[model samples]
Target: MADDFTPRYGEVEQMAPGIRRVLARNAGAFTYYGTGTYIVGNGAVAVIDPGPDDADHVHAIRAALEGERVSHILVTHTHYDHSPAAVPLKAATGAEIVGCAPLVLDDNGPRADAGFDRDYSPDRVLTDGDVVAGSDWTIEAVATPGHTSNHLCFAYREGEALFTGDHVMGWSTTVVSPPDGDMADYMRSLEKLLERDERIYYPTHGAPVDNPRRLVRGMLTHRKQREYQIVALLKEGVKHIPDMVARMYVGLDPRLTGGAGRSVLAHLVDLKERGQVRETDGEWRLCATSARD
Candidate 1:
């Protein structure tokens, strides 16, 4: 994602042969430069991620897609910034809201459904190997549930471009907040992508990822390093999550402190589940077997 990007907020930019991208005006800490709504195909198109429920964004999509039939409104996940506009876009174009299932949780919490788009109601929930088509393009669903349980990456069969929505990103490593986000499942999902042959990855957040497998390998290594750092911190009597976060993230933005805590908690939870660490009261410590290992 080192590529240069000039944010022409509502203009449609042609990315590749049959792919175009529109930038929503919702930039922030989490969203590097806001959500990138991708429009695939020419005549009858499939719009992936209609973006935030901004009226302007929806109108931009409708305007850009004027005279073109919207075959499908595909959402990768139900994040607030990614799925809300599907409602209005579908109403405007009468497109089928196809993709991930709606936000379903056994229960909810601040950390559980943080940044979720609960209003996301899918017309059809696509599973792995499910395909949706336009006139000249086809999208195959790649079920990658990590950033969120319902997260799906759509693969364009016309070209080997994978629309990786938050599962794998360019600007930064994905945050695996727990109760919904799982580090174990996230790691498994990353390894699963290694088996694929998608040449370029167009993440919803930032710039497109070229040579994506290389980035995936590095992401795996980075996560493993985080694991080691957490274990080392535990060995040094850092029993609290906040202390671990301070030691692990030296210059993290204060605004992202809560997310950092959630991330550390995710690692601890994964470790505890695997018997590598044990939680006592509100503290965490390495298991004897893991210490030996």
Candidate 2:
């Protein structure tokens, strides 16, 4: 897989006059541009979503530093590809890592992909309103947890440019992977961004978006359309995530089908929570409506 995998390398681009975005090139299951790293202010740079554990990628980042002080490494989430490299990068640059608190363990157990290394733990946990300052620039933390519970998006308050991790992208819709990824939370997070007036969004993967609110609305509409399609499928006798995925994502990539199932399951969970559907004994069905039997 590694050999076949075309590493989507990253290049540095300016998001604002002082903010530089490093777009990664790894564009597959393992790494979507790896992670979009940002350098803010001169000599006081901040790296967002440190990306995968690729030595070359890390080296590229170190190269990009080019004598500028790397002051902070901010993680949008703790997925292996995005956060694991933060530790080594921190070691190399002596930058303080920042992110959300760990997940809450239930009686069932810690959620899938929850616990992260304390070594990679952020020097400071970023809350909804915390600010990371560069030379003269400031990146405000926005708690946009959807792709993962710990997900955070950093916004440059000056130009209203947002560093959107997996929450939003220019090339593709993000995978709402479960255990940590929730459709309801994701929808809310989308709405959160929609309500904002950000002009540009630099995502962890792919190119930057110019009109983020429009893109957010488009994503929201797509989700709603998918939800309705799933509901209709259930009404017509499709009874589980696998079935809905098979029917809805016909002729799609087999590998991506699993991720599709995760999104479908998230929709099902949201529908059930909304009293629009119900699941029992591994089967799913629509709730009784006034117009339907």
Candidate 3:
């Protein structure tokens, strides 16, 4: 199950029949082994998530092309580590950028990663069921907004494999920051994937998910458990996100607590919308009827 867990920067490894993965150099807490830039098909190929704007990474992608024509540069979302390289790749290959629109965050919600590629406007905006066909590959876009409002998962029709983006990754659960990310939408999106018959998922980060259903179900269960814990803590008079994070995520790395707090806020927002919880002056509490019900 461990495939390229310790990924080397700029290494192009063949994954499936027509899919090859190029690990980007940018590795961190968020991006497990950097970003996995997938190249699908041969002769005429489609690149998925071109990754960061690193010159060496872009050169690696160009070299991986091996003179093969790049018909499409498909992006999952506009996270800094995921989409910025598309610009340079497109400039080099004359490939049209295809995928979700750039994310727009509201000022009222939890703070989001300001480093996202704000200028990432796809040549063609893909809806839930839109299809992008190449000479050898046909990808169907599945709009899966949660990690970001415009997040997309592309299904490689010929291989029955899903390029899941950050919608579902095997390494860790997706971070659902608010305004840009919606927990309700995230849960619904998870349910949406359950209807698909794809056997495998190639997420932007981490190794491939062979048991997609099980992994996705586990993700849902984990989210539900966190939500339950938050609700229970609310009943105990835990009023703010920081307090909730401190109590719920005990022994968590101090640096990650900020991200965890945002996740808790996302859950609270969802609960508040569902009438299960209420927030006043940034203080959260369990609803009386909801607690009884």
Candidate 4:
């Protein structure tokens, strides 16, 4: 709502050894403003998640470089706030834009205010274990499909830090809105991060998480809690996706209600896939055929 909420919401900060973060400014409904982007290595710098297509923001990145060339533009995901600007930035700097292909939007279509659309696409698609070479730093891609199927995190191969696109963040739990978002896949991605001994997390939108291990644990626990709450609500006869969403997300902001429903649907779909719930003629209830352990 405010004119150019970026300057007020974003901040540029240093992470570790060879990393710098550009934090987004505002905490808009869908945008994780003040999130950090890393500048890895030296002479040949690589900018991660260029944020939005704001002229000033791009200028700021260029200014920070102070004439240093940006060899590669790496994106964590296809969300507009994170990747849309890659096209312009690539045209300007001639940096090879890299990211995974956009995720397939679910049947319900995208949330009204969602930043990205199904039409969004990346220049070069990356998969798990792929590496992007830079002058000073080499980044290894880690496919973390949960927030969206296209989510990718990059770990600096030199043990410097991990660039967590939206897979994880310091300010909040990354939303798993369906049809693109998957709760099960998101948890697996979190578990994958837990298996690593990385030191820091350079998120796309917020501050660098100093204690990534602890944050990962907290995120996992939080999602588990949500799942428990949903399961409990189901026991109370809250049938159908919309009904469950109404009761489970009673006090959430109106704007986020749809996103919350998408998350709830993802959880329900996961439960159903595991034979925990059943949808018959548009109604959702505990699957009568499943055995209770």
Best candidate, TM-score-wise? Answer: 1
Task: Estimate, for each residue in 30-62, the C-alpha lDDT of model 2 and write its tens digit.
Answer: 244356677767777888888767777788788
- The global Cα lDDT (0 to 1) of model 1 is 0.88
* Top-down lDDT ranking: 1, 3, 2, 4
Q: Which stretches of candidate 1 lie over 4 Å from their true place?
A: 1-4, 104-113
Q: Could you give candidate 1's per-residue lDDT for residues 1-293 as a string of tens digits? A: 23476787999989999999999998876777888999999989999999999999998888888889998999998877889999999888889999998885542333322567867888899999999987799999999987778889999998899999989998887777778888888999999999999999999988889989999999999999999999999988899998988999999887677778877888899999998999989999899988777
* Tens-digit per-residue lDDT, 1-293, candidate 3: 24545666787899999999999877766777788999999999999999988999999998888869999999989888889899999999999999988764443432233257866878998998999988899999999998888899999999999999999999888888877788999999999999999999999988899999999999999999999899888878889888889899899867567678878989999988888888789888788997775
Residue 178 of model 3 has an lDDT of 75
Question: Candidates' lDDT values, in order?
Answer: 0.88, 0.76, 0.87, 0.74
Worst 10 residues of 3 by lDDT: 105-114
Angstrom error of the Cα, residue 228, model 3: value is 0.8
Q: TM-scores of all models?
A: 0.95, 0.87, 0.94, 0.86
lDDT: the better of candidates 2 and 4:
2
lDDT of 4 at 265: 78
How many clashes would you count in candidate 2?
3
Count: clashes, candidate 3: 0
Best by lDDT: 1
After superposing candidate 4 on the true structure, give the runs of residues whose Cα lies further than 4 Å from its correct spot: 1-12, 23-27, 102-123, 289-293
